[model samples]
Target: MTDTPDTLLDGTHTVLTPEYVEFRFTLAGIYSRFLAWLLDTLIVMVGTGAILSGLSMAMMVFPGFASALGFVIYFLVDWGYGIALETAWSGRTVGKRVMGLRVIQRSGVRIGFYHAALRNLARPVDRLPFLYLVGGVAALLSGSYQRLGDMLAGTIVVRERRLKAPSAIGAAAGEGLLADPLFVSRVKRLSAEARELVLSAALRREELRMEARLRLFSALGTKLQELLAMEKPAHLSDEKWTLLVAAALIPAPGARTSTGARAVA
Candidate 1:
């Protein structure tokens, strides 16, 4: 990770992979996070209001039960909102997506259900003393602008940024691997989902533990080898081979564009 004066000041979290590839992301500040939270809160209130309206209508028959049920529903909606969306949407909620923010683990990987739930579960404490006063102060104090929830969950909210494909991308893949017509053809035949997995693995390889890194790249490389109907090059390791393929199959900016006919894992 290269730490320049500007990068430090602006909260750029850069992760360097084993292959010396750098993944850089800008940390979301408290202001953007607050805006995102406000939007989510607004949405949740509308949804809860709709549910409460039905409960209010039923309250005529069983006022006590319906009133109690309404309270439960509000709590569930408020607490479940972030957990549900962040898990299903891969660290993005309606508000976060709209604001171009995503919650990811400290290692720069996507957050899963556990992280989402833990973070959201801590929300009540973060909201102590009204208007998220404690959370706001915590974020201001944190270099990465993490609130209590984020700190507890080992996650940080980041703003999505687009990176351009570099010219002469074949260097990482060894001398002339990308120039081989047969290899390029096989890469182009990989499905969109396969392309993404390969690239993500290659780019984030260093973030994973050694065992995980080996297993993942081995499985990925083997699958690609079978799909492409080519023997693994004897000189390259599994991880290196996978990185070569990823370098060949570059993801377009902000979208997954593909020119493939067959599906590959």
Candidate 2:
């Protein structure tokens, strides 16, 4: 699933999931991402400046406590700045927001505190030997334009955009093949919630963001593969397989509609 700019279609990286969702994220290039990092650094510097100013004033009043306070502020400003802002702002610090960039899971999942922490914790490594030289090389060479921190965190930087529902189902719209008896049995074995989840995703596949659709279908496809104790044919995409399974389990009208259903995020 790794994709470099050279492999991108019309300069956009496509993330496909087994659920038939496809997300086309325009990767934030090394230069833009660096600029955003610089902005965040400036913010950190401002906070540091304020803390130092306060510490200097306090040093005259309480010289003993000044040293301790400086150390604490230094640690917090160096690390806590990024962690606190990213966790609270859904992966955006002041610089990222200003640069119209955001951090998100490569798989299209929402980032959590753990992800933010992991990425930030690895920041020092990314900065090894100076001005993010290691991270710069990694981003330039890696598919998804990821730095070491992003790779460690399974995250990516993408330009922010409004998520719009698709007007029609793209890959999810197709005639499903008849289910094999074994496949049918496997389908029946799934829990009601699981079955309904697949059906719902299939029904609303058209309206989902490409990345989300791909993720859903990929996950469902893997689940089906496990249940059926079979491997997917190389020719069949995850969405196709999941749709076939959905068709077998749900034969209701409009289940295979050419026009996609409106999806609610």
Number of the predicted model whose lDDT against the real structure is largest? 1
Off by over 4 Å in 1: 1-10, 16-22, 64-69, 167-244, 247-265
Model 1 over residues 25-127: C-alpha lDDT tens digits? 6788777788999999999989898988876767777876976787788779988998999998768899998887898887777778999998999988999
Compared with the true structure, what per-residue lDDT tens digits does model 2 show for residues 1-265?
5554533531455666554556556777777788888888887878887978966876788888887887677657868988888888777888888877788787655477888998898888989989999988998889788889889899988776533322222333354434357666776677644664565567656657777777777888888888768787778899787776665664345466432221212
Error of 1 at 43 (Å): 0.7
- Candidate 2, run of 10 with poorest lDDT: 163-172
Q: What is the overall TM-score of model 2 with all chains considered together?
A: 0.57
Question: Which runs of model 2 end up more than 4 angstroms from their true locations?
Answer: 1-11, 58-72, 163-265
What local lDDT does model 1 show for residue 121? 90
